[model samples]
Target chain A: MSLPKVRVPYLLLFPGFAFLFTFFILPIVNLAQTSTQTPIAGGDTGEYEQTFAFSNYIQAFVDNKEQFARSFVFATFSTLLALLIAYPLAYAIAFKSGKFKNILLVLVVAPFFTSFLLRTIAWKQILGEEGFVVPGLRSLHIISQQTTLTSTSFAVVAGMTYNFLPFMTLPLYASLERIDPRTIEAAGDLYANGITAFRRVTMPLSLPGVVAGTLLTFIPAAGDYVNAAILGSPTSKMVGNVIESRYFKIVDYPTAAALSFTLMATILVLVTLYIRKVGTEELV
Target chain B: MATERSLSPEARSILNSQISRRGVLAGAGGLGAAGLLAACGGSSSSGGEDTKTVRWGNWPLYLDFDSDTKKYPTLEKFMTETGLTAKYFEDYNDNDEFFGKVQAQLKLGEDIGYDVVTPTDWMAARWIRLGYTQKFDAANVPNKVNILDSLASPSYDPKRESSLTWQGIMAGFGWNTQKNPKGIRTLDDLFAPQNKGKIVVLTEMRDTLGIILLAQGVDITKVTENQFMNAVDFMAKKISDGWIRGVKGNEYAQDLTSGDATAVIGWSGDMFILASENEGKFDFAIPESGGTISGDNLMIPSTASADGKKNGEALINYYYDPMVAAEVAAYVNYVCPVKGAQAAMEKIAPELVNSEYIFPSDKTSSRLHIFRSLTPDEETKWAEAFQKAQGN
Candidate 1:
């Protein structure tokens, strides 16, 4: 039998393809081209000439390796912490909350209603030396007077986890809410306790959400500069801050673009490996 | 809408499957495109008509506003006299940030959407050096004669061909009176063991490093790379030792008020405002080694048409009138660059007539030093060192 030809489907793809080509693909191509440029000789502050200086990538990596390492380290910690916090909260909202589920979900996302920068600044205040957190801890002799919380790695990580928690929770909640209660009940009847049932049944089923949530949290967290800027000290500065300063302050676009491409490539490779390890069958 | 709700399940499923993904993706794409458009927006119109509307970009709280009238009185008066509408924008938050925003357009000789912009001295010098600014018609600004003699000839524009001073501020050490009862008299005092983790420095490279260089007995006016590197090393040591709390911009004032910072390297005008609000809670002191003085300057970008330039000059000329200058000085609490504004303040706001910070005493003036303009190469090197020390 001959298949029916359809012109509508191909036409339907045009808008999406055009949009991505103009906004995404074009910019990435431009950024890739910019990554190889070099500063013009005796030029003004921001002047540059395209020289195909692939060495920019090496120079950027060498100069900012510590920042790059710190970025991934912080992102990994924050992602793990967010998962640990989000899973339980998502589970409760999915199974425990009766009519208040929608409200709980809104509560999970209420922090986003405020500006991200403003929220980060609020965190700075809360963790400041003179703020309630430090003084209270000092009063209880839990921390020394000079041991501040504001400009530290811990604060930066905590801020990232807090800011990105919703990204982890919403996905987990969607997958968890769709779970069949009968399967878990059957597992219970088949000589399984609550923990065993969850591990054997629910956890494996929620792999898609876990994978999706972790990727969402990790990618943006790795590129986050505001949290580190507001809460972290120079010692805790991340790669994102370096890129920002290079582009805006130093006006060194080539190094900034090179670092950006490196970051994107690193994330792409890591994500591919992660998906493969997680198994493609669960993603659908 | 009612008919659409009555669709069959199979048909609705097919429709939803096909349209939902594209709909969501299209929505997101539209949002992204809107943001990109907004980011690149500026005046695209060329000047042929009488550009009666002048756009002025300035820092926040730099002009007096009548609470009762809910309008900038001086600006209103200027507009009525010139028959021109002035659109004032308080978007000049930081000099470098503003420069980064407009530099691309300025380089291409395109309008940055502002007829007048107020950038700090170093940035203005850079603009003049790059030929990105238009010269003011001296004939259009007769009130320019009232400009302070000391400010009439900056090294960057000795003839005052391109820029005019808006406000000058002293960069010095300020401390909370309640927090530091003994007082912070010098850079050494700020770095003393007792003040550890309570000190905050400015993020502006010139203000922070210039003060440090001055403290080290190096003249900031013509600092050498060795002197700059030494200052950077000293700053890095303080940062690594946790002696300095953080590097901040305008937020240093908030840090001071909240007691997060006991002492800060801050602008004199900000210190005055903070002190006045807190009532003896804060005090500003110029270090014995002298403090760095810098000014925000008004200049027309090269993109401005001849008509726009004239209107900008008219606005500048109006503000340069000693009475109008005094009005701005009384509200802004910065050093007025117009020479006769001090005497004019005697009638306008008598209380501020002798305010030393706004109109520096001869002794105070003698102790203030200007950080000399750096060559492009030196600027890049110094900025890189500063950024590294800043942990970027």
Candidate 2:
């Protein structure tokens, strides 16, 4: 039952390639087909035929440009926030945690034990009007009576940042942990100060992680609907929400597919430009 | 379950209802409620009349369930009597989502994992129109005659051939008693200054817009496009002006409980469950202008195997029994659609015999209006408009 030596690698790769073809590539192809479809004449609600209706993209984009803009804005904010929080924690765990590093890493991933939906819904309650945080802030004159946390864009962004923090932290931790301590000493030996040594030497070495972490955080954040659905009001709706409502609520499969393809294309282009600008050709 | 002599009827009823509420709340944390009754029965199907399993996909907390046993009492009884293994799943959160999940399979003539599905009235219409459901065998469902007169002739299934009414739902104003001391009876009251930015409305287009259309002095039963647009415009303005918080589904109950919403346009059964669970902290009222009434229909999808369909029909027939329907009505507190259920309730839960939510009187019934069925074109148009107003 053993495979020939030359064919062994191909045999080993068969399952992964088959999985990617079936679950990933097949759906993308189907989605692309659906994107170019037109509704059948005298047919049921969700029935469609492939007509290569490229105008579907134009129509979906024009109809949802505001959501498109809001999604990127929120994703950008959440990515920046996640980077600010995750970088320092990952740094501490990598360079300064001594023997407690593994425990810290486990703690970073501890929130994952619970379901993502549950965690997001928990945030909705924690920042809710009746939740202790809001009333406490109100009593301390930190927020006005009319001001609320839940159902606001701020809540949505906060939820996204929290949910995606581990995505940012783990990659950053791996890259930081891989940095040899001697590189920093070499910079210091060359008359670089602590801040200069860290910034010039450490930051460049971790560019791969920064590129990876930001991409991981931003791509999903841009397409997320649950945070907005649970913690945001109507004004904070994202493109993901539009696609969802179109597919389920309105049963507009053509429009939903068009939006999906558009979102995928937009994110791919943005990620390409981002990697090129950051000049990190190896990480992605 | 409460048999103490010192307890008043109201207290006993409250205790009984709380027991059910505990069950619902324990299992209900998110909109995606997936519950399997016992272990999933062995899937290998026997070829002929030996089918011993029935799988039903229904809304959460819709049946009479005992939390401690994690079993549906009526379903358990049905299994014992018919020697059938019943698998019930609380999988229907929204009509469109559930339909979207199985529509492709249904179109391909494949089993969508359930012998029976309970879709709301409008959705059932779509299923029947598309020939996606099988007509019930008249001999198998002999108790179908017990359907209430009002529900026996819905536009979707005039002859009761394909579907049976599961429960009638009335949508109106529900508010926190502490937040709205004066109560919310009309749209104006619902939009009062104190309730600004604290109001939640249903994602169901008919119920939310039906209430608004009624307040605008428009008959929801025959709403014109212009009338519907006006209601949609009004809702959009409220959402933009930060007077309404969210447009949500059954999860709106979370907002009500977490105090993110002070008032909502919600369903009667949910508000009743919330009120009982929270010590009467919540209340539901039919808007003075009237409220929307709809029903979820139980039907066997066409993809079901013949034996599966037969088992499904038997399950449907068992639910149509007045006593069994009354038992479910006592637990869920929705309007019972079985004609003799009220009389049967007098024996099972006497305190709920006259409960307006379960057995509305003439005055209560008069205030409830069924949102008329829509044309397919209008369905897409109106649903798009509704989602647009919600900023999706």
Candidate 3:
């Protein structure tokens, strides 16, 4: 005898779906609603009324273009730097390490064991004017007495690179490990040298990982405010810092929400275009 | 019905159980939604008369702690005498940050879980203006007579109904004596060539801008937007020219102690605390032009129940006693806001009774100016301008 079909999968998803609907989707809807609100006449510190104020986006953009540009620039630099540093390290672990591979991988990810804020704060001490690095550099005459490393753009970019390095390394290591030794050997047998074999065979095969690593590093670096807040000066403020101050210190939720939406939309458009250009057919 | 008839009895029963499970799941989901709605509509008061505990939120290091007992002496004494439990929290960090955390609940007239909180003058003004605070019951606090006349009627609460002065602090220049032996005497001294990139300024807009306005020959208490922006412009130039090392809040103390900054626009209380630790290595000076004097004030939030308010008032009254206030003042090292506390301090800690930072002399008091209260528009505009000047 045949039994009637039951929709168990849909039933299993109902609880989780309801949770996301209530928490995630509802907040997004509320944020979107708040983005179009304006302060009421003579309202108290944080009071606002819905006015369909679409110009808030334009106003936020105009007011904070410098911060937006700085964020993107910092993110781009950090992504490229992370890739440069991580690719070789990941490649070594994938191909060169014999018995110490596990330990090295653990070392690569060990920074995560500490809190992100604490690690960033440690960087502050290391890069401060009174810190050993600065004093040593000054004694060597590499930097002037008046110059500092703690509150500069370089400090901010270095912080972003350091914080996001593991994100780039893990993905590259995964892709690189999947590369067959036979392919490289075949290229070598076909008269290609070591560099040519890596360029043609290994590198091209690792494009998927490259795309994933860069996206992972770049997206978070763009939205990071902590490093900038702790290690960088006001001149190095990023869009995330502006958004943070707007929300917490200024209590201007409408402008902050509008700015957040604009940032999200911009990042989405850029990422989509990037993925499309990179072509993800060979990602697996 | 046709499909069910084709199924075997066992399979049909299994299917029936599955349907029942789905029904139970839907019922649970509906129940959860209703529970959430009920929670949202629940009473917002912190506690009723049955609660013998009062929650007090304050800034870090603002209380007198007895290291030997590992407890706040005055607070422990109060609890013992009154048979009340005091849940003390040092969670009141930055004014704006704490306000942001509680503003929504406060706006809804809901408890933020604190019966008493100490906010600075400007923030207390905003709380009073928004009706977010409850008036003190004078009958509950008979020690209100000990409140110093100077702090009795602040412009924010002219009748002293909603807030009582917690502690007064001065915003002035703090210098590392080893690094800058000459020390800072004026705001212009901060801009000197040798001091470039070695000077840290406060992130508090009022303190920083007030001093700059004072240096520019403008009164901080009657500042116009034009005057304020002019002062801001001066700061903007200093920051862009690299004359200023960084803009910081409470962390400026770390910079000074670590020698990352030789001079800083810092708080008097912090400098006093730091100097005691480092001996003659550091010194604080009221800038020759003047310095900003601000105070943290205690108030009961609107969401506090009548019982909680009574308990909070009793706590305030306990602390307002001259002997208890002196103990707190001697430990905290801030300007005492209770009359007779200085005299009471001589018996408790004679060494601290003569400290200028704790009890300013008339000449020093004359050099301290209070930042004017801002209108709503001015607050927004000035904050935006200051944030812009700070390059955020």
lDDT by residue (A1-284, candidate 1, tens digit) is 64456867767899999999999999999999899999888898888889999999999999999999999999999999999999999999999999999999999999989999988889988888668988999999999977878778999999999999999999999999989999999999999999999999999988888988999899999999999988888789999999988887777889999999999888888889988888878773
Per-residue lDDT of model 2, residues B272-313, tens digit only: 877777776788888888888999999999988898999999
Over A79-166, each residue of candidate 2 has an lDDT whose tens digit, in order, gives 9999999999999999999999999999999999999999998998789877899999999999998899999999999999999999
What 10-residue stretch in candidate 1 chain B is worst by lDDT? B3-12
Q: How would the docking of model 3 be graded?
A: acceptable
In model 1, what lDDT does residue B223 have? 89
Ranking by DockQ: 2, 1, 3
Ranking by lDDT: 2, 1, 3
Candidate 1 residue-wise lDDT, B33-133, digit = tens: 33443354334444443568787788766777554444578998998998998877766778778998988888888678788999899889899989989
DockQ in order: 0.43, 0.83, 0.40
TM-score of 2: 0.94
Best by lDDT: 2
Task: For each candidate in the order shown, give its overall lDDT on alpha carbons.
Answer: 0.83, 0.88, 0.83
Q: Of the candidates shown, which would achieve the greatest TM-score relative to the real structure?
A: 2
Q: On residues A102-122, what C-alpha lDDT tens digit does candidate 3 reach at each position?
A: 999999999999999989988
Better of 2 and 3 by DockQ: 2
Pairs of colliding residues, candidate 1: none
Compare the candidates by DockQ and give the number of the best one. Answer: 2
Q: Which TM-score values does chain B get in all models?
A: 0.87, 0.91, 0.87
